[model samples]
Target: MARRRRPKRSNKEARRRAIYLLPNLFTTASLFSGFFAMIEAIDGNFLVASAAIFASLIFDGLDGRVARATNTTSRFGVEYDSLADLVAFGAAPAVMFYVWALRPLGRLGFLAAFLFAACGALRLARFNVQSDSAKPSKHFVGLPIPAAASMLAGTVMMWTQTSLVEPIPAWVAVAMVFVLSFLMVSNIPYLSFKSLGLARLRSFNGLVACLLLFVLVALQPYVMGFALLALYVVGGPLGARLLERGKAEKEQAEQLEHKPDHS
Candidate 1:
């Protein structure tokens, strides 16, 4: 029998092969989750929509880790991730929230959502440009897009799961729209987990804490997610203050160490 010939891969084909599959799959899933969340919101399933948004967050977190682990991180992946984020974290949430809660407030509701979407885009743009030299100090320059979206989603989940009086109080929802939108564009610093890679091992105590957190989340997912998102939103200002205080103390200590002896 004659030997069978294998088809040759072109350079472009070879590059395509290098892209990771599992991670990209996760990314696509995240994008779909976000898209579905929007559909759920429009269908009046606010609870499901909110939950889907959070689910998207999980997928987003997984994609990067999977890519890194598989050595498949690439410029294409990065670009795709950002685009998905804009749709999932920025546009979907804005539209969902506006129609769900903010719509009652008339034009102001949509305006706030619009601001959030615009600010989110700007934030993503800044991140892309500054990713190389971004500081890992105690905080981020602005509220992360994902975090902002999570906050909104978490709040909705909290209200729904807790059987709270209302899924979203008109006043609170309005205020939140403005607050979240501002945070997205503000100069406030927030934590970035990028430096804390998945490989970092925690102490036994930390492991216990993680277990406890898991339990709490399992027991009261709505409350836990709500508290977590709220804490993270507050964490920015708190972290910034702590960073400033630490800087001041360090400067003072250095000055004392270098002071001349009176003797």
Candidate 2:
């Protein structure tokens, strides 16, 4: 008697599995980059470590877009991405900063690094919860972990390029870490830029602006990267304050217009 053969999987199922794996693969690349950054940092290769973090940032950005484009997004992907982010944008940067500039402060330095990671974890958790329950908005509720990580990485690159003999002041590093941690957990609105439709822009001026930006960045990546991240870090709070002031003025004007004239 011939033995019965096991049923073979369908091509559709195989293809589906492969497609779903794509985004997770990108997430793994990001995680690997972040882990490499930590290792480089420990070995005192800070410039390499900073570059790795930025590499991780690029991978992190691509995974979400790939998932969405392929319509293969799932809860597993979301959670995996968050875990990768906590490593890439949280622990890795903390370790890099701690080793590069925070080591002199000893306990305060390490603690500040830990605080940044913890705040990043909290930020990711809050974002996940909000994404699941709230309507999708054009703004993020707090500073994105990647942006915060990029800021630190940019600082490292910029500092390395500077001609100053003195190391970054301990107080300045500590203050920067503390402020970034606070911003991560704060409620300030940060533009997500998801609604910009950059992929489908129809204007020549927009294309020229983007080309100019690329040229400028290529000319002085370290300086430009730090400057851009710094502007983004400050823009959230400044923009909010400006919007509040405008609203107040508009309300005052409306009240004045409604007032009865005494003639």
Candidate 2 residue runs with Cα over 4 Å from true position? 1-19, 257-263
- Writing each residue's lDDT as its tens digit, candidate 1 over 1-263 gives 99999999886666545666788889899999999999999998988998888889999999998887877777778888899999899988998898888888888888888988898999998888877676546457899999999988887777766767655777889888788888888888887777554358568877787889999999988888789889989888888788899999999999999999999
lDDT per model vs. reference = 0.85, 0.94
**Predicted candidate 2 versus true structure: per-residue lDDT over 106-220, tens digit per residue:** 9999999999999999999999999999999988988999999999999999999877557889999999999999999999989987878898999999999999999999998
Q: Which residue pairs clash within candidate 2?
A: none
Q: What value does the lDDT take at residue 199 in candidate 1? A: 52
* Span of ten consecutive residues with least summed lDDT in model 2: 11-20
- The model with the greatest TM-score is 2
TM-score of each: 0.86, 0.89
Clashes found in each candidate (C-alpha, N, C closer than 3 A): 1, 0
